[model samples]
Target: MVTPGPTSPMSPAAWAGRRDARNLRAPVKKSRRPRLRRKQPLQPLNTSPLPGDSGVCDLFESPPSSGSDGADSPAARGCSHAPGAAQQLAQLDLQTFRDYGQSCYAFCKAREGHFHPRESLALQPQVTAESRCKLLSWLIPVHRQFGLSFESLCLTVNTLDRFLITTPVAADCFQLLGVTSLLIACKQVEVHPPRVKQLLALCCGAFSRQQLCNLECIVLHKLHFSLGAPTISFFLEHFTHARVEARQAEVSEALEAQALARGVAELSLADYAFTSYTPSLLAICCLALADRMLQLPRPMDLSLGGHPEEALQDCLGKLQLLVAINGTSLTHMLPLQIREKCCLSPSLK
Candidate 1:
């Protein structure tokens, strides 16, 4: 008989059970029984050992049971499971959102004054209003290159203005601050934000990815995460929808006019003089100016955005000047048909 070898690390009962299970199999002839069989580790039933396993224990990790801790994920609970994409469109009712459009605009209109920048540049020691204008001018073309929505650009400018007042930014970092604001605004509204690498590439690698990310956190924290401010795009759409509903303009005409007005609004965004005007005032003036420039059969009323006549005229004067100054650049921003339809030329006027 072959001498019995040292026992396996398994419990006595477990070893006995294992021996009983092995005995049930066909007995090996002595000539075929290898000597090393006695020295090999006894593996538990129902499990094959992995190549590198030490085999001290045979317990398996299970998925994280929901509500167990209510916070830990499967990965946190010692398993590697990725979660599903979050549902941003859950519980949306398109008809209801459209139906409530006017009411939503009214809510924002009532809050417009709260969002207007008050002496916004007073605290920036290194940055000047001229610098602000130049930065926004560059940003307008950048926004077009990315094909971001007018709302995204409006939100970006709003975010930048709100954050600018909260901290004194260095002139050197103003461009970075602008791009960081764009990123935050895109995250708030766009389906896919531009990649950080791409945005930095636009800057010719003047800023690092970490610097952009760090400034993003600083902006979000400084604003206390409040980003739902009323914007020029919001009020502009409201006025256009109202005009269409009132039958003062054709659907297609209103759309074209709104596009022209959006270009006007973008032009205004680059001028520091226009920042102090409430968004509703600026939006109405842009729409009204667009309609007058287009010479619509029935132009929208100046009172549509609910500003007084005096404020309306004042804002309108500034918008007319802005349009006159940037006529060439604004024309480039619009569709060819829209530019031709609106007569920026003095002879046409």
Candidate 2:
């Protein structure tokens, strides 16, 4: 055995063997050791209570009853909590809202002349405006009977006009066309649409279920599946809402005004003379007329430059004449279904 002396040169193999023997004889050290934990920054405690944090707060409060005198209550003033309340609250700047309204009005006003029923009538002379009005008048009772929304009613009329403009049909098929349009509108707008059986019954069996379905296909195809036209009622709702906000009108008063506006709009629907007015202009005129009837302190501001003042005045005069000729009272001129549903009698003189 060769004994390796300190400071003496040794073969590389022998040195390696010696190092391995020493490593094996020594105890193996573990690589793992307890890691030092990092400290986290502490959060500050909230000191103030948020709005509606108390159990007594009526955050999601209901509107005050019509009979109640609590018109100043938050809910009655349209301050009730709703879904996305926080988001709406964040955007509750009045000036900002008014600006948005003006912009929306401008946009809709720009597109107004494009959607007049007169344009449609020009193409299809066979479908006279008088016949159109008669059909729309009939739709009111049907709309009420089925409990369809105002949106559905307006959409139905829009579909009717668009389809009539593109395709010419015989006078006998007008009812069928109206029924199919109503079906399409209801399906698009209602959560649960009126069934085919209900529609057939409404038509008094004038149209077979197959005929109605086929007509629907024809209308849909003619319109290219575009049923998203903005109707007078759509703009009317927004204008009415804005009027309420602008005037800070009470809920009952607002409701009454809107009901009157809707009645006027429906009356316009029955007259071909109103067809020359754009939906926006017609809506503006309706709001203006309703405000006048109510004799409210604040008049609606509907003056967009280039608005046909002469035409609006002419239409308003016609509407007044219709109301006068139809019945002895304002409520009488309004469809009975609208009067009862909107509770218009209590507010109107």
Q: Which candidate has the top score in TM-score?
A: 1
Question: lDDT tens string, model 1, 150-237?
Answer: 7888999999999889999999999999999998988988777789998999899999999999999999999999888889888877
Residue-level lDDT for 54 in candidate 2: 71
As for candidate 1, its clashing pairs are none
Off by over 4 Å in 2: 1-104, 123-126, 248-251, 304-306, 328-349
Question: Can you tell me which runs of candidate 1 are displaced by over 4 Å?
Answer: 1-98, 345-349
Best by lDDT: 1
Candidate 1's displacement at residue 203, Å, is 1.8
lDDT tens digits, residue span 1-349, model 2: 9997779779999999999988786668989988988588777554344476673434445433444364334333333111122332333345555668778767766765555556667777578888888888898667765656677887887788878779888998998898888999988888778898888888788879899898889888988897766688767766766766766565445555666777777777767677666777777777776766666667677663346678777766776666555434446545344455433222232
